[model samples]
Target: MASKQIQCEICFKEYAVGYCKTCGHIGDACVDIHNTGKVFQTHSVIMHEAVNVHEDDRENPKVIIRDASEERCKQHATERAIFLCTRHDTMICGRCLHSEHLSCGKEVVDLLREVGSIDCEKVNTMKSLLMEVKNEILLLKDDAENSKENFKTNADNCAQECIELGIKIKQRVDELTNVLIDEITKKHNENESTYSRITRTYNEKITWCENEERKIDQFVHNNMAGYLYLLSRKFDKGVSDVRSNLREIKHKHTFKRFEFKENRVILKCVFEDLEDVCEHQDEVTGSDDGSVNDVFEPTTEIQKTRRELTALSHKAKEYLDKSIKERLTVEAELKRTKADLNRVEKEIIDN
Candidate 1:
């Protein structure tokens, strides 16, 4: 008789489930272990315990392997394990579980197992989408490069314009300043000359008045001592005789007339019609002299000229302000262009 079944590893217990009780691994004699095939049977208990592994219940016992597919490994011998998602026109990995597409309904392993017989239309669509993204990115890169070059060109032009305008403004300021100084100087010189001429004329008039006063004093002295006595002695005569005597005395006067002309003087004296009646002869003579102006002050012409210069200076400043505003506008445009170029560049990099 054959020996009754006995537990080899477990003492005092028979093997009931056809698996070892010590390690929990299936027994070597079981149909489940023998019929499952080498691929599923060689896995350790650890792997079986982690997954819900089971036998296929078809007419024929087919061994089933879990989580085994090309998508999980480098099947194409490339770095990327690309799985085409045709519905979304994207590529994903075995770890991706996108729910957008019916084709992604299967697990990553089953999906890669059938990658060879995938729909041709989905593959074509994925390739078309990749090509479109590449083309768009290339166009955007080119546009960004062109924009940067254009901004550089515009900035250079603006810098040159600013330099040119600044030089022009400085030159204009210098020219205007010189003109104003020269005009003011000329006005000062003219005013000084006028003041000096007027002062000289007044002084000459004062000197003439002093000389006339001396002459009147001498005439009065002569009249009181001799002519007055003669007149008092002749008071017994008629008034008409006294008037005739006074007229005859005036006909022989020494200093008689002083005349003034423009910035000059003239003297005239008469001794009646007698040529040898007086000791001194009558004559007229004058001398012309002048001096440099001591001080200068602005006249009305100077004030008007200064005002006009101020107006011109204000106009120049206004033009400078306009030029500066134009420069600022150009700078603002350049800044905007730089920002646009940077943003476009960033977009390209991100893409």
Candidate 2:
């Protein structure tokens, strides 16, 4: 008898059915695994009760160990199988009948001495299954061949899409840049027209003031009080006009300047978006969430910063543009002061 949990001498694996009566080697014990043969009997009831065992069935392989081609029980590797589990509807070993049926308790375990034989219908059904499996294997090989072609096609499409998308992005950026340039040009032309108009107005005012000064100089030999009184009202009105023009230049006639602000974060996000698209092509579908879209819709803090910068630039431009205007306004004020001084001198003479 073969002991439990011992290695099979033929396959060198743990567990076997029984030892040969002649050679004493377990599992398929013939001249192929051992050097002995010529067995007259089999030892099937070593630890199990002999059921349906007969003397006339000595040469048959059905009872196991009666012939050398006895198959091992696939369900029970370490024990003789004679029990049929009622719950699972499968054959199990002698140990399984006493133990649990898949740990469902021994109450559901049952034993039956069932027999199986291949008739014409059974043979035909098995043949059909074998053919179906063979055809499926051939179809699997066809899929393997088609996979290479499909991969190449998909790769080429991906490469073309990448290049086309890159070109579109470049064109989009160029179009946006041109729009900004056009805006700057339009503003520049408007500012130029305004500056030219202001300059002509200032020139006309200067001419009027110069004429008044010449008249006052010529009236020096006349009755001093009477001449000075006639000129004071006219002089005051002229000074008021010059002061109003200077105030307009200071408050309303400023040229709004535009500055190009570079957002590195936008460029960084684009690069990262591209990388993310490539990393998970199957997951990341392209949406309209480009970085340029947010550039026009600036955050409140960013808009505030831009406004502050523009204010600073306007101040700088004012300083640059008012260099000549400052001199003109000061000259007009000085003329008013001199006229007052002249009137005082006349008053002193009269006293």
Winner by lDDT = 2
Model 2 spans > 4 angstroms off: 1-150, 217-232, 277-351
Model 1 TM-score, all chains together: 0.30
lDDT of 1 by residue, 1-351 (tens): 111232422233433233321233233344254346565565333212222323333222222233323222223222234565555545555445343334555433334556546688998999999999999899868866876787688678777866786687679769977887777677667666656655665566566557655655675877656654554464446345545544554453223232324332211211231222212322212124423223343333323343587799999999999999999999999999999999999999999
The CA lDDT of each predicted structure is 0.51, 0.62
What's the lDDT for candidate 1?
Answer: 0.51
TM-score of 2: 0.34
Error of 1 at 210 (Å): 3.1
- Candidate 1: lDDT of 116? 49
